[model samples]
Target: MNENENISVLFKIVVVLIIVGAIFGTFMSIVNFALIRSISNEISTLNNLTISSMNDRMNRMDSDISSLESNIQPGGIVDEYINAYNFLSNTNLDLEKLLTFASETPDATYLTVYIAGRSNVWITVTNNGQSLLQADLKPGLSDYVFFISGNPNVKTSYTIMLAPSSIITTSDASATYILLAQNGKTSILHTKSPSLSVSNILK
Candidate 1:
């Protein structure tokens, strides 16, 4: 062939080789990028699954711990404490019922009086103008016993007088009276009784 034609053919071959190299490099880059993205997605999915499994395990562990705590035996401290409290409460109720029964019986020889006050006071109990008991009472609650002279089954009248210890005059003192029977019936004598004068009748 001629020298110029040979040079032209060599130039065309070089150009074609360059174009093929460029296309191959671009395709390889695209393939590498797709592989990297797919690998990253798989890694993220694996991490999510691991986290979910760990959370499920933790939840199960918590539930097991709660169940163990709830399975306390009857001889445990918590159970014993509850049992003792119930026993004490029941015993107190039984004692109260017994006292009430005794107080309502016809053979009972004494009457009980409960006093509640806001301040210190002097109390006097009288039956038919005869003084039965005289004492000093402090604030809060107090119980007193007075013997009955007559037949307990019959109706009886009694008087209670309360005077503040800080006061000297009897005019400011308050008085309450009642008629009670052994059958556990009572009637208040005064209309303007003190608010703290609460009584329970036994049956």
Candidate 2:
């Protein structure tokens, strides 16, 4: 072949190579753009799901807070006045029964008396018209004593009793008393009193 013909063949080969290179570059650019768009879409979807989950959690928390607030309000599940009344009535009944039993029992000895939150009360024991013991009690305090009958060889009859003291009208308070007999018998008493107004309101 002549030199011009060879030169023309070389030019055609160079042009074909340039066209192939441009086509390949365009295809790669398109693929890259498609991949970037898919990734962006996925990221947006993930962000939306995360925000929705956070909002749901916030709404649940708000509901829980509201329920708690309602439970603690006045006339809710817990009533302070009613609780006080029940406490006082139950305590007074217990105390009355304990006093009556102690007074009527034969050979009774005042072993111990507990007054809840009252330091000014005390007890006195008398047998055959003679004073046996005088004990001082503190508020919210418990104390005990051992008693022996007048005759060690015989079971002596005695009287055990408490002095006239003011009753407790407060709520959420209680007292306990314990009595021990020479023959190893035991009696326990408890008294609780609630606030008068609170009790009255419930009724």
Q: Judged by TM-score, which candidate is best?
A: 2
Candidate 1 per-residue lDDT, tens place, 20-125, comes to 9999999999999999999999999999999999999999999988766765553455644654454344435445633543555455334443222234556655
Runs in model 2 lying further than 4 Å from the true structure: 73-203
lDDT of 2 at 89: 53
CA RMSD of each candidate after superposition: 14.2, 13.1
lDDT, candidates in the order shown: 0.47, 0.49
lDDT of 2 by residue, 82-134 (tens): 43454455447456644543443346333444454333445444444455555
Candidate 1's C-alpha runs over 4 A off are 72-203
| Top candidate by lDDT | 2
Model 2 — TM-score against the truth? Answer: 0.40
Q: Candidate 2 — which pairs collide?
A: 87-194, 88-193, 88-194, 91-192, 117-140
State each candidate's clash count.
Answer: 0, 5
